[model samples]
Each structure stands twice: as structure tokens, then as C-alpha cells.
Target: RLGELASLSYGLAMTVVAMKTVTPEPAESGALVARLETLSNAIERLPRVIPPRGKGEASAAPPPCDLQDQIAALTSQMEDVVAGGPIERREKAPEQAEKGEVKKKKGGFFVSGAFSDPAYSRFALKGTAAVMISYLTYTLLDWPGIHTAMLTCFIVSLTTVGETVQKLFLRIAGCLVGALLGIVSIVFILPDTTSITSLVVLVGLVTLPAAWIAVGKPTVSYIGFQIAFALYLCILQGAEPGFDLVVARDRVIGILFGDLVVYLIFTRIFPVSTLTQLRLDLDKLIRQCRDVVKTKAAFDPAAGAIQEAGRAYATLETASANLAAYGYETFHSGNRRLRAQANKLAIKALRGFVNALAVVAAFPPPQGDAEKSEALRQLLLHAEMNLQTLAFSLAAPFDVSSGALVDSMPPALSPDDEPSPQISALEALMARLNNVKMTLFHYRRLLHTEAGAYE
Candidate 1:
């Protein structure tokens, strides 16, 4: 049955592909194209034919001749092309080979120049220094109880100072909450518990809420695990029931100490600002949007233009998420509030721009209307140019005098124009083009605003 269905699907797809490829001249063979369409539809409605499984089983019925008819029609249409000449294969370009080599060289993690960047090196050294400080504090001071300090450093370390600080805060909050719960269990619950069953019940009670929290959202989930960890340490110190406040105290101190060390080292020495990273991301997104616009202008069905658009959308999503984390960052050099406001405005504009681009891409200009196609192409070109300018502006320092703001309006159609489907699509694209301009204008304006201007 599956085989029959697969064959039918393949036949239908091939029929459709052939229908799209063959452009029958209205004066010459329009009737032939109509017949092919009818046959393609008939092929889709054909019944599935299951083959005989054994010698006694009945044989499957033969398929209809619609497929053969469609193939014959396609071949007849292509007869002129077949008679013209044999097709020639083009050789690969040297530039393309060089590009492929460059892509291959930059593909892996270790070879991606990650260690070459000073910021990455600083981040690495900072984390290593934090762990070493914790390790030495516990070992040299002969404080085995606070050995979890080293573990805490490993758990909370992150790439950026803002991210690391954010994780450290979560770790601290989770640790404190967990420690409190552990202490409470030790005081009230442990005294009443006699058997291992009662102790298990107590631990389970504390663990239930912690597990609930741990499984929650990423921002607050660490609190839940910390709650479980703190409670477990205080309750399950040994095989026998033991209530020692000192163990909980030591673990909590170790976690807090590690956090403090990380915080001071990451923030005070060679700190990587999230806001700076956000700017770079915003720049990359603008360039991606430009590429998307450029791809949409040409609009190739088989050249993976859709994949490029998908990647741009993905970058937009990542930039938005980083903006959210940007709020938690306090280590930026400039007027952090002003930078945040500008970024927020720019991101909102970018969101609208991307959405408008999606609409424009969806309603491509009709292929038969050369004038409308050219007009749409012009609009996309204007948008692409403006996007390129915006990206350049974002890469450098913002300049009020820079002419980043350019007119992005599409050419207006005449009021007395005929009401054709192609014209309507063009009109829709024109409206979206106006929206794109508005967003670009807003983004350009935000970038132009100086720090003092905000004050």
C-alpha cells in the first residue's frame, strides 16, 4: 500500500513539475496544455494499487495512461529545444573554489580564531583565575568543608561578564533559598523522622518543590536545582540520620564565596560588556537583512533564497534575546540607559522591517507584467541600499550628519490603472515598501541621536 501511494505521489509531483516547465503558445498548442492539466488532476485521483504478496493473492490493477500522456505532451513541447542543440556543462570558477576553501578553513570551533581574540582570552583567564582562587582558598587554608567553592566557579562561569554575573546571581539566590529550606528541614522535619522511610519522605517533600523550580524557565530554573542541592546536603549527610547546621553553613558559604570571587574578577578586570556585543549583533542582523532583500530582489526558486531569509530571522531572534539579557548588564562604559533606549528602538524598527520584507517576498510581482516586475525590483533595490547604509552606520560610531536616512518609497501607480491581479500585488508591495521606509527612518533616527542629545 505504501509503495502504491509513493508511486502515485511521485507521478503527481512529476506532472506538476512538467506543467510548470512547459509554456505552450496560445496560438499553437493551448489545447494540448489544457489536456495535460486535466490528465495531471486525473493522475492525482487515481486509486492505490497493492501488489500481490503471495502466489494465491490477486494481482494489482494497472495504472491509468494519464502519466504516459502527460510525459508525451511534455516531450512534444520540448521538441524544438531538443532539435536546437546539445547542452554544454560549465566549468567551476576559480573564485568559487577559493570561497569553498575559505569556508572549509573557518568551519571548526578551535580553528575559528576564538583564541586569537583578546576578549575571549581575557574571559578564559578570568574564569581560570576565579576557579584557582576558590581552589587555593579551600586547600591552602585547610578548609575541606568549603571545597564546593571550586565546583561553584565551574558551574557559574560564562562567556560575557553580564552573562556570568547573571548566572552568579541566580546561583546565589538558588543557593540561599536551598540552604534556607535545608535548614528548615533539619530543624522541624528531621526531629520527628525516625526510620529511613520518614527521612526519605522529608527529603522528597523538599525535592518536589526544588524539582518543580528546576524544570521551570531558564532564568529561574537554577534556583530549583540549588534548592534541591542545599536541602540534600543538610538532610543526607550520611547513611544514618544526621542534623548538622555546620555542613549547610559551609556549603552555602563556599557557593557565595565563589560567586563573589567570580563577580569581582569578571567585572573589575577586562570585563566584556553585553551592550557592546548587542551592538555587533545588531550590525550583523542589519547586514543579513540587506542580504535577504538582495536575494528577494532576484528571487530564485532553487538558489536557497528562502534559507537565507530563515537565517536572517534566526539572527533577529538571537539579537532580541541578547537585548533582554542586556538589561541585566551593569558593566558598560557609556551612558547605559541611553544606549539601551537606542538599541530598544532600533530592534523594534528592525522587527517591523523584517516583517514587511516577509510580506513583500510572499507577494512577488507577476512574471507576465514586465513593468510591475521592474518597479518592484527598483523598490527592493532602494531598500537594499538603505539597509546597507544603516549597517555601515551601526558598525561605526553614530554620526548625526551622516545621510543614512534615504527615501525608500516605491514608484506610484496611476489612479486610472487597470485592476489586474499583478497590479494589486504590486500595490500591496508598494504599501509594504512604505512601511519598510518608515522603520528604516526610525532606526536611522535612533542611531543619529547623540548621548548628549538624549540628556
Candidate 2:
């Protein structure tokens, strides 16, 4: 299931990238165009269909004849609008192309580069070393019963040491819990169960809850699988139900040994810290938020920008979730508490900024009010520039100072004069932007302090 989810996410991300890379066709209007053409043709044939009105019979002008010219004119105008849309898009294409170029320039590394860094190689190497060590330990020792040690390595390995450690702890805890349950079943429940029906009922009773937990949130879901595993090992030990304490003990020991090996390897060897990755993820998310603002400012459809921002947000959230494993990380520099606090603040601020952008997107620009439209555009531009600076600062090395924080607010538009919905929406967006800047400023300060402590 997790693999399926990952595959879906990857496919969605690729789709978004493709959508951005390919120039979309102008808004679909084939149906409208066909309807207009049919109307125009019918109007052209109308005069031919009607018999000529005799002058001798009441000399009143036919209403259909009178309106034929007007109908034809309206149809022609509609057709022209529909036909000219592509021309308008073609005229604006160069300007859009220039904007796209500017976006690419300002995007920096987070936007243009692959998600994985050079540390990924180290990550792979560490995981391989762990699995190999586990395999050699069990195989050389001729301990076939403890082969689960090798299996554990594969299941617990993750991109960052912190995430690996987190999973390691989860695996161990779940194994212990499941083993205890299995032991209890072997001691008490197995003796009472005689028929296969009774054994089936007993297994179902245990598995029902385990499956429930497995289907729950990702963090705790592994526990359920482990519970079921341990119970099965103890309860079902062949064709028929047989109590096997020795096998259960060996499996549990193998799992624990594997986890220990992985933990040591990941921590001691070129450890990929989640804290560092969290900073990078935060930077990516900030830039994504900036992209959202840029799209809104350019009067472009924001669906793609919003989708990217959402993906970035999820990435950051996952990183933040792994922060708990910092306690298990060895040779870690910087104050973990401060780093976690900074991360939390960044998440909160970005979430607000994304929500505000959504609200801004909801309200269309004021119609026939060029001044108000321009004012909103300026406000969005201001927000975008500030976000860009923040993202850049975040992407910089932690030891390097980020200069002054972004305290300058976007110039406020006079809501009294315009008092339009667009102005109100922009105001809300500015408020959120201010909150984001302040949070980022605080987050950076926290990081500086952490860096100083490490130095």
C-alpha cells in the first residue's frame, strides 16, 4: 500500500511537471464556435426560406426580415471573438515566455534541481552496508533461524538516518509488542483451542486489531503488521496449529539484532541528518509559495502552482514528522530543540501563506478598475519578491549570516478609495505574507543561534 501511494504521488508530480513544461492550448471553445457557425449559416438561409411578402397584401414589414441583419451581425461578432482568442494568445505568448524565463532564473536550486542531493549516495551506501553486515553475521555464524536480521535491514532502511532510526524504533517496539502477545497466546489460549475453528477464531481475534492498527496513520501502522507477524509465528508453526516458543524467540532476536546493526551503521557512517534535509525542504516550500504568488500576480491560472505548493508542503510535513528521531542521532551538531522549533514555525507560516493565496485566488480582480487591478498586482509582486528572498536565505549555508530579516511590509493600498473585493482579498494575502516573513525571520534567528552553539 505504501509503495502504491508513492507511485501515485510520483505520477502526479510528473504530470504537474509536464503540464508546466508543455504550452497548453487556448481555452476549449469548439462547441461554442460550431454553434455560432451554425447560427450564422441558418441566418444566411433564413431570407431564402421565407416567401416574399406581397405588397398587395398588408404592407407590414416581417419581423424576421427586420431582425435578420441584427442577428447576423451578432453571430458575426461572436464568431470573431471565438476565432480571435487564439490570435490574442499568440500575441501574449512572447510575454508569457519572458515571464517563464524570469521564473526559471529566480527559482534557484530548489526549483530547478532534482529532489535528491549528493548525500543520497551516502544514504544508499549506508543502507547497503547495514544489510550486508546483517547478512554476513547470520550466514557466517550458520544461524539460519536468525535470518530475520537480514530481512529487518531491508524493511527499516530509509533516505535519512533520522527516518531510518524512527522506523527502527517503530519496528523494534512493534516486534516486542507482538512477541509478548504471541507468548501470552502460546501460554494460555493455545491450550484451550482444540479444533481448527477455534484456532481460526483465536487468530482472527488477534489479527483484527492488528490489521486495524496497520491501516491507521503511517507512523504507528507498522506496529499492526509486526503484531500479526509475531502472533502468527507463535500460533501457526506448521500444517496444524503448534506452539513454537523457540521459533518466535529466534525471530524476535533476529529483528532486534538487525535493527541494532542498522542503527549503528546509519548513525556512524556519513549520516544523512533529517535536520539538514528539513531546512532544504523548508526552502523548497518557501520557493513553492513564491511561485504560487507569482502565478497569481501574472494573472495566470494558479492550479499548477497550487499543486506544487501542496506537494512541497507534504514533503516538509514528512520531514517534520521525522524530527522526533533526532534524540537517537549520534554526533549531531546544533540544538535539536531550536531546530525543531524553527521548523515548526516555518511550517505554520507557510501553511498560512498557502491558505491566503487560495483566498486571493478565489477573488477575481476588480472589473473596469485599472487602478485597483494594478494595486493588487503590485501587492502580489511585493509578496513574491519577499518570498523569493526568504527562500534564498533559507537555501544558503547555515553558518553564513542571512543579513537582515525581511521586516519591510508591502506598501498598503488605500482600501478607503477602492474598497473592492479584490482589495480586501489582497489585504488578507498581505497579512498572511507578513506573518510568513516574521516567522521566517524568527526561524532564521533560531538557526543562527544554533549555528553559533555548534561553532
Candidate 3:
């Protein structure tokens, strides 16, 4: 049920991001400090509910906080953690990454598409795959039956099981129900030229709404259309106006054959990690942190913005845990070394990005004397350029090992160089974004790694 929201609310959230409001103008420093103190004290007063320490550990009871209160606590904690004073911030050294290079920089449609989360790719694959299965099954059977191999495959892929099991379940449910509905359509509505055209139009109208309703809805609607199409084909062929059991059998056989293809391809050609996304998402977090750190050059980030970003990383960590589960599920024989390597680097990348971001932000350049990190001073321009590349989803040249790489990049995060109060409280937000990005890549790679599973 909730899965349906992936298409609906997910797109809506993206639309909201495209329409973000500009930061409000700042008042006096005294006013800002008062606000910062208020937020910090509020955060300090809130209840803390830490996660279970290890795998299989029972979760402790959640300490309830109102939305506002929770936001404050996370912000305050992120600042404290990143400040690395009383509590040392966790560190992930860089050399852990740098394994692979960009194989090729894509252009046009592929490049734009890559900037987005890849979960939707699976959905699109379902549709196209469904169409293929239907056409193939019918052709193999000499086109005797108006088969629904395509629609069945679409529905199956809509379900989670990665590919194969998802295909199996959805295909079964959709085809059976569709076939029954096709029978009803034949019983009630004629399939002459006019009627057929009307039926097609009706199918389109029905399916279009579900497309907006969400991804699965379209698949459901497609199944119904396939059912109509199948029975219509039989009727046009002048078959008797009753259920044809033989036709259904033909349909299933063809569908299974096609399903076999997808499954086999997945398990063979490339079996990838669904958790592969963490690397990219973590990469973004690092860039964002770098941006925050540079903010001090022009403007001191509202006292807690850096901390909030760190908190967001913690939330991302939680998502990473779930992603790790997928990692376990997707690993294959003979690929243990690659999987291990990927996971280790992934964790380091995740932590590194978050910590780096927070550190720069928390270490505010003194008022009226804004500079950059000593480790990165020479690389300021390069870092900014790299951040822009990451921000825009471009292929950036990564060579931070040079002795001249700077600690903080210049050019504040906000336009007109305004510091933000929310920056201090984004612990959950970072996690949420990182989680979404990570999950996306995880699905893509795992699907790739197990491409043969669809067969």
C-alpha cells in the first residue's frame, strides 16, 4: 500500500524542491545570537533516543519529541558532534575511496537521467519488459493466442523481489484478473472496429490517471488493458463467446519463457550492489559540507547550520543500515571480494562526507576575518569548481591527494551570503536525502548484478 506513494508523494516532494523559497534577509547579530541560543537550549532540553548499537540489537524505546523539538535536538547535537570538542567527531580517511574511474561521461538524455534517482528506471524497465514478454510469447506460440506476457511482466516487476520473484507474483495476479475481465468485456461489449477503437481509448484514459496516481497504478491499469486486448483478439478471430482455457495456458507459457530470459541475464552478465548509491549520496553530502565550511569566508552560518548538516548524516547512516541488508541479499559467489571492498568504501565515504561537511561549518572563520581550512587553502578554487560539478551532477576530476588541496572552499552557500538557522538542525534531512539516493543506486546495481534473475 505505502509502496504506491513512491510515485505520488515522491514526485510531489521533488516538485516542491524545484520551488524552494529564497533565504530571508538577516536582521542584527544580537537578534541572530538570541535566536541561535534559543534553538540550542531548546535542542538541549529535548529527549534523546539513541539507536541500537549493533546488528540484531533490540531498539530502545523512542523518546517522543514534537516536530519542532526534534528538529532542535538534532541541530544542537550535530553542532556538538561536528565541533569535535567535548565529543570527537567520527572520521573516515579519504584514501578508502578512489578505486574506480569514470568509465565514460554520458551526454544528453543519459546524463540528465543519471542526475535523478534510478528507482524509476526499474519501473520503466517493467513496462518495456512486459511489452517484450507479451510479444515474444505470442510469436513463439505462432501468435495463436492474444497473450499477455508483457502486461504480466510489468506487474511482476512492479512488485519488489528485485526482479524475478516480483515478476512472478505480479504477473500471476495481473494476468489471471485481466483474463477474467477480458471475458466480461467480451460478454458485455462487442469488438468491432468502432468498439475496438473505443476500447483502446478507454484503456488509455483509465491508465493515464493511474500514471498520475503513481507507478504501480499504471501497471495495474495496463494489466486491465492487456486483458481487454487479449480477449478482444480472440473475439475478433471469431472464437466462441466463452472462456478459452487453452489461450490462458499459452499466455503463461510464453510469459514464463520471457521471465526466464530476464532472470538469467540478471544473475550472469552483471550482478551489482543495490547499496552502490551510498557512494554518490555520500559524495554529495561531502560537497554540501564543503560549501558550508566556505560560508564563513563571507558569512558566519547561523550558529547551528553546520551541526544540522551533521545530524542529517546520522539519519543517512540509518538508511545505510537498511541498504546494508540489501547488500547482503545481493552478494553472489565469487564476488565476495568486490562486495566487501564496495561496502567498506561505502561506509567510509558516507561518514567522510558528513564529517567533512560538519567540520568546516562548525569551525566558523572569525567574524570580519574569513579564510579557509589550512589543509585546503590552495585548493579553494578547485574545491569550489568540484563542488559545482557535484552540485550539477557533472563528472568532476577527483585528485585531492595533491599537497595543495585546501581545507575549505570559498564562496558562501547562500546567495548574498546569508547564514541559515536551519543549517544547524539538518541531521534528519541529510539522512533522508542520502538514504533516498543510496537506496536508488542500491536498487540499480543489485538489479544489474542480478540481471539474469528476471529470466
lDDT of 1: 0.61
lDDT (10s digit) by residue, model 3, range 1-455: 12222222232222222123112332234643465566456445644443323333323323312222323333344433323313323343232234454344446756445447565565456556556756776777677444545544444442233334433534455445555545555555534425456666645644454344334442233444444444444343342343455655565555555555555443343334333444455555555455454453344432343444544465567546544544434444366555555565556655655554443344333322233233233333444454454444323332323222212323344455444332322222234334433433453353346432222
Q: How much lDDT does each candidate structure score? A: 0.61, 0.64, 0.43
TM-score leader: 2
**Clashes within 3 Å, all models in order:** 0, 0, 45
Residues 235-341, model 2: lDDT tens digits: 77789766778888888899999999988887677766666766666666676666667776886533344454555557656655654554345325557666666
User: How far off is residue 415 in model 2, in Å?
Assistant: 5.7
Error (Å) of candidate 1 at residue 355 is 2.9
TM-score of each: 0.66, 0.67, 0.35
- Give the local distance difference test score of model 2: 0.64
- List model 1 lDDT by residue over 110-148, tens digit each: 745676878677877888999999999999988888988
Candidate scoring better on lDDT of 1 and 2: 2
Q: Total clashes, candidate 2?
A: 0
Q: Better model by lDDT, 1 or 3?
A: 1
What is the C-alpha local distance difference test score of candidate 3? 0.43
Model 2 poorest 10 in a row by lDDT = 86-95
